[model samples]
Target: MDLGFGREKRLLTPQQFKAVFDSATHKVSSKHVLLLARDNQLEHPRLGLVIGKKSVKLAVERNRIKRQIRESFRHNQSILTGVDCVIVARRGIADLSNIELRQQFDKMWKRLARQRLAADQANSTGQTNA
Candidate 1:
């Protein structure tokens, strides 16, 4: 498994997850609901995804969706700098093909850009080396 953003050091822990969830700004895009998050407000890019069982009950289905999301970020992490993004999968996701998934992600990112937090290379990098 590709784990995530490459390095394991930067992945979100339960503590970090809580921090962002408690204070991050949020928006709903046509594709998915984007959780625009920050820690104490950290100033680097970070990302997390939540594909619920309700949306894709089978592990295989959920994992496939997750792989799609992670790969999207791994390649486009630079586009979103300072803000942390969390994509919580909804039921509709179960029906999407890769093309449709990308379309949805694009929509979500475009919407997220409006309220984005700037990313700084220093302090924290934009991704977790998962």
Candidate 2:
């Protein structure tokens, strides 16, 4: 698969970030991460990372978390289509290894994808019945 974390696959502006936070329809939380997801009109998935200094403390640690998150998202882009996701780093997340972080993110991404598929099916069925 083509795994490239391009600018188009990132939530860049304040308005875009606010839209995801304000209208999130799915959320998945793990020990050190909380993923908030919203359905978007686009054909591909986009990601936003919120590794605040208040939570992570050091810039090096925060950058590591962001890199891991982005890498995981890049590899799972196909399954995450049509969704905008924001990953918020919780306190103590900096201690987790990259493997553990990827595993948690993978689980949450699958759950979010399933939720989106179910919602789409329900909408399609309702439209057909009407």
Candidate 3:
């Protein structure tokens, strides 16, 4: 229940971000966002955001979108454990309000959790079959 957006919960290095992008096992996408996730072999989830200037245009708007994404991730971190997630902002994301963004993020997080569960089950079942 520690819901703080700590430094440990952020994808800080270029190599870390590249690893998630290059080897993501799960992806969730909407009109305004693309969420790519890979297992990080850690106890907590980490977030990396890519809000390109070409898509968002203004620095203020991009910063606002990042804030919304970080807040949403922080609130849902418990359920998002053991994954490194990268959220790429698409063109229309800047137009949405914080509430709408949060809603979208919530859905994406649920989808990711489901995928993780299914993958775990598959692994367990495969081991049993062997």
Candidate 4:
């Protein structure tokens, strides 16, 4: 499994981030973060993080949050195949410990996966019935 989060696994451009922001197909949120996901055409999933300074004042905190988010995404990337995911940090996120953030991401990833699977099944059945 290619678990490395290389450049190809990142949403690198403005357009790529905008695409997910404009028409996110799946959403999973918690008190400290919100994740928006849209299906993409690639064979792998891509990730974008929006940990603004307004949300987390210190640059060090922001970087820490980004690291945690990326690590979580790397472990759970398989569940997010062919999707573009943007995770926006909310206020108070900087207060959470690494373990707490990890747990939150794990739960959110599972929820998003269940949602996507349900939607895919619904779409497939709808097309067959049409």
lDDT of 4 at 71: 96
Clashes of each: 7, 0, 0, 0
Would you list the rank order by lDDT, best first?
4, 3, 2, 1
Q: Write the per-residue lDDT of candidate 3 for residues 1-130, one digit (tens) a residue.
A: 8899889999999999999999999999999999999999899999999999989999999999999889889889989999999999999898999899989998899999999999999999999999
Give the best candidate by lDDT. Answer: 4
| TM-score result, candidate 4 | 0.98
Tell me which residue pairs clash in candidate 1: 6-129, 7-129, 7-130, 8-129, 39-42, 45-126, 82-119
The best candidate in terms of TM-score: 4
lDDT of each: 0.63, 0.89, 0.93, 0.95
Candidate 3 Cα outliers beyond 4 Å, as residue runs: none
Work out candidate 4's RMSD over C-alphas: 0.6
Please give, for residues 35-112, the per-residue lDDT of candidate 2 as tens digits: 899988888899999999989998998988898888889988999988899998899998898898888888888888
Residue 28 lDDT in candidate 4:
94
Judge candidate 2 against the unseen true structure and give its global Cα lDDT, from 0 to 1.
Answer: 0.89
Report each candidate's C-alpha RMSD, comma-separated, in the order given: 8.2, 1.3, 0.8, 0.6
Better of 2 and 3 by TM-score: 3
Span of 10 residues, lowest total lDDT, candidate 1: 117-126
Question: Model 2 — TM-score against the truth?
Answer: 0.92
Cα displacement (angstroms), candidate 3, residue 53, comes to 0.5
Q: How well is each residue in 56-127 modelled by candidate 4, as lDDT tens digits?
A: 999999999899989999999989899999999999999999999988998899999999999999999999
